[model samples]
Target: MRYCIERLDGQHCLFVDGRKELLIYLKQASSETITDIRKVYRNGVSDSVLEIYLPYRKQ
Candidate 1:
C-alpha cells in the first residue's frame, strides 16, 4: 500500500511506503485527537500527522 501526507503549511506532501510498522501506526493513530485545522490538499496528503502528539510517545 501507498501512503501520502501533506505538510501543515500546505506546501509539501509526505509519502510513506506501506510497511508493517507504518500500517500499524496509521491504524492506531486514526483514533487520536486532532485540533481544528484548515484543509489544504484533498489528495495524497495530510494536514497533520497525529501520532507525534500521542501520549504514549512520552515514554
Candidate 2:
C-alpha cells in the first residue's frame, strides 16, 4: 500500500492505496481529531491496490 497527502476541492485529503477502514482510522488519530471527514473508495483489484480517499488534517 502507498500513502500520500493531497488537496481536493480546496480540502486536505489523504490518498491511501488500501482499505477504507484504514482511512477512517487515520482520520481519528490521537494527535489531532478530525471531525469533518469524507470517505471515497476508488478502483481496486485486490487489497494491494485498493484506493481510498479520506479527509486529512495536518497534525
Candidate 3:
C-alpha cells in the first residue's frame, strides 16, 4: 500500500508505506506544532496515508 503525506503549507507531498509503523515514525519525528494529523482511508481500508496541518508559518 501507498501512503501520502501532505504538508500543512501545501508545499510538499511525501509518499511512504501505508503502515502503522510508518505513521508512528512520523509522529515521533514531528514537533508539537504538528497538529491535525489525520489518516485517510479508501473504502474503509487503511490507506496508510496521513494529512498533517502544521501551525502556520510566520511571515
- Tens digits of per-residue lDDT, candidate 3, 1-59, equal 55555555546555556566445656555543332333556664543212332322221
How would you encode candidate 2's per-residue C-alpha lDDT over 7-56 as one tens digit per residue?
34326655555445555556566423333333334553223221233334
RMSD per candidate (Å) reads 8.1, 8.6, 7.2
Q: Candidate 3 regions off by >4 Å? A: 31-59
Ten contiguous residues with the weakest lDDT in model 3: 50-59
Candidate 1 residue lDDT tens string, 1-59: 44454444446544555445444544554322322222235464535444443443222
Which candidate do you rate higher for lDDT, 1 or 3?
Answer: 3
C-alpha lDDT of all candidate models, in order: 0.41, 0.42, 0.46
lDDT of 2 at 45: 29
lDDT of model 2 at position 46: 24
The alpha-carbon lDDT assigned to residue 40 of candidate 1 equals: 35
Deviation from native of the Cα of residue 9 in model 3, angstroms? 2.4
Which runs of model 2 end up more than 4 angstroms from their true locations?
1-10, 20-28, 35-59
Model 1 stretches astray by more than 4 angstroms: 19-59
Q: TM per model? A: 0.32, 0.25, 0.40
Question: How much does candidate 3 score in TM-score?
Answer: 0.40
